[model samples]
Target: MSSTPTDARLMDGSGLARRLVEETAARAADLTRRTGTPPCLATVLVGEDPASVTYVRMKRARCEKAGIRSRHVELPATTTTAEVVATLEGLSNDPEVHGILLQHPVGPGIDERAAFEAIAPEKDVDGVTFSSFATMSFGLPGFVSCTPGGIMRLLDAYGVDPAGKRAVVVGRSAILGKPAGMMLLARNATVTYCHSHTADLSAAVREADILVAAVGRPRFIKGEDIKPGAVVVDAGYNPGNVGDVDFDTAVTRAGLITPVPGGVGPMTIAVLLAQTVDAAERQLA
Candidate 1:
């Protein structure tokens, strides 16, 4: 059957992110009004990867627009892992900083996990810390990884009930893939994770009612592997802004699909701002 436009809905992450950011800005203003302090996010970057620099700058710009304060800490390319961790720890201890974001791919030598763990759990608004992961896995009250949290928000906004659904998350990165599966599991979805080591990846993907492609390879998940009418969330942001799922073919098969540039990207920053506000509110209380 030839699929009509109504056969698949384009999940508008940009639109939803705009609404979320607006709400977050209002909350940030209200919090500042009540506490005499604006919610602050401290962004730490190790080494100057051009893409990481641009991403951090964008996040700070969003923070400014949302009425949140941003503190930037830039380290040299020669900085050691311990130095990076120490810098993050200092920011974590700063009372004025309600959120901490350590831009990923801090060069090749740095121990990324150790640095991520340096951020205090309460201020881990980017949700990279072990404590934050545990909390998110348990469905506890804690900040979640921005991308995964944003994905969940998109799901909710579109009225995609995950309860009893079979969800396949393609990738196992701590921040994006693993957390995404955990979030879906929390919502009562039977979740399966597929990574580079997973055998028969296509077989797993074919079983999913909901599929999240976060493997970071452009057009890695083919349309033939997608279950018809599946909810497809493409969270990959590779060079040229291409997504993991082959969008042109997958769109015809999916019941709903998120576009590459207009989809998961915007929601990530929106979730960060919202969580920063939430952290600030909790700290004030």
Candidate 2:
């Protein structure tokens, strides 16, 4: 027997990112013209974790494409937590650096939180600092975690209002999952958070009107568990460019879904560049 195909729309994050990047580039150009100093984003990384290196490289490439200046600092794998903190502190104090991003998951001995806290609030473009989280949670005007910010943008672009929706966020990482649920809550959505430890996880997922799969496990969220016509945002980026949701089956059930590579990845970088420009503008103001 043949299964009937469902009519689900694919969210084009890459297209949205391109448009946002163009706007950011224009703002960067205008900022440079007015202040004679281009917006600069400094990236700090500890160790040569392949993922971290790749992320920095992608960010740097995007920065140049958007007319934003970039400074990169890569520390040794043996770097201590204190050294990492000092490095971030130095970047935080640099006059030329409008935004500072300390790539996380430092060496095994490093305290990631301590390193994140070293970046000043005003310059925390990546939104890893507590100050940023506080403002974001309060719905105040401030920097946001880049990936979450991007996810919100995607929702808006598609006219998916969170108000009164049963939004379920899988995974509770500080930057992506936690901030996303908080932002949705600020928008009046009834939010539920689920992690690996969440009992009866599939049941919680099925109750969601808007599902954000961010567990970082490839195809961890089965398509059958997705509520019919629910909007799905797959935030996981596993190896082989796969997402947490099984798109093949999810596309048949969800009203809207984001594809793996062309979905959240580009938006994350786009959000970062936009925040960098925002930081520069605020500093000059």
Candidate 3:
């Protein structure tokens, strides 16, 4: 028997992200002209993960182009959670620092969660703070997790309304999976949260009208499990920049699917910059 042909649409996050950055740049320039102080993002890196360094550099470069200033604080690999927290606390108290982004995966001995919590909710532009998480879950006004924010932006761009739709988020991490689920719920989606503990992963996925693959395991979600016509957001950044969903197969079943590397990754930074400017505006207000 022949397989059912795929009829999926592609969501282009990179293109949208580029547009967002352009808009953010304009906002930053306007703010600078009015307030005489450009928005500033303080980037805190605990270790020297080559990938993490590259991401931070990309963010800084983008900020420069946007007319925003960046204050970088790179700590040694041996920095402890206490030290990291102290540094974040200092940045939080600095009026000039409008936003703070503590890069993830500090080191083997470091407690990433504890370090993330050190950021004050007001300056937590990356949306890693407990306060940020609470606000996001409640659908209140607050900075959002970058990747999830980007996902929502893409959904809005594609005219995919989540209201009354069955959305399944396939991960539960604080930064990505959990926040993505909350964002969907806020948009009126009937969201089902699934993770490693889920007994029937495929069943859950198949029931989704909108499926988000953020489980990190590359190709963990099979195309056969995806419901036909479902919107798929693959937010995985695995080695080789592959997504959790098997794009080749999932695209066939999904109504709209995001491509790895070009999808959520670029959007993350765009949202970060936008949020940084927002934070600065809020500070002045």
Candidate 4:
């Protein structure tokens, strides 16, 4: 027996990121000519988590490509929370620094929330600050968490209007999963959030018109869980660059799906750059 192939449109985040970067670079050049001061993003990371290192490196490399300066601070693994906060505090006060991104998931014993709060709202380009989250929750114009921002952009690019849809987001991280649900809610989607404590993950996923898998466990969501014709956003950045949903089966069930590495990952950095430039524009004003 022959099976009919389903049409699941693949969302190309890498392609969109490239175009955004080109436009951003042009704007960065114009800004250089206007003020003779280039926009800079200060990246602070504690310890050497491989994933964090890769992410920070990617950010700096993208910044250079976009003509945005990057100042990197690699704190020693033994550094105390106070020292980390002090470093970020100093960067927050620097007028020359247009944006600040403290790479997520600091070492054990570090107060991540306290460190995030130390960043000036204007310079919190990564959108990890409480001020930023509050604004995002209320649908105000402020920096959004990069991964969530990217997911919204992806939805827009594909013409998947969230208005009146049943949107389900798995995971509740302050940065990725939580903000994504809030973004969908702001766009008029009825959002449901599920985490480790949820009783039935599959049931929650099936009710979604738009399902976002961001639980960080590779292949946690199976194809059987997806609602047919649902729009799937896989925002998981796990080991081996795999996503939370089982892509092979999900594509058969989904109307659209974002791939792991080239999907939300690229878009995250693109959003960061855009926000950084926006911060610079605000500072310039």
TM-score of each: 0.97, 0.97, 0.96, 0.97
Candidate 4 segments exceeding 4 Å error: 1-5
Q: List the lowest-lDDT window of 10 residues for candidate 4.
A: 1-10
Q: What is the C-alpha lDDT of each candidate?
A: 0.93, 0.93, 0.90, 0.91
C-alpha RMSD in Å of predicted model 2 compared with the true structure: 2.2
TM-score of 2: 0.97
lDDT of 1 by residue, 197-223 (tens): 999999999999999999989999998
Reference-based lDDT, residue 183, model 2: 94
Prediction-by-prediction clash tally = 0, 0, 1, 0
Task: List, residue by residue over 39-156, the lDDT tens digit for candidate 2.
Answer: 9999988888999998899999999999999999989998988898888889888899999988877767888888899999999999999999999998888899999999999999
Give me candidate 1's TM-score against the actual structure. Answer: 0.97
Model 3: weakest 10-residue lDDT segment is: 1-10
Q: What tens digits encode model 3's per-residue C-alpha lDDT throughout 1-285?
A: 124356566788889999999999999999999999999999999778999999899999999998889999999998888999899999999999999999887888888888888888889999998899998888788899998999999999999999999999999998999999998988899999999999989999999999888888998999999888889899887997688988878878788888886888889999999999999999977
How many Å off is the CA of 45 in candidate 4? 1.4
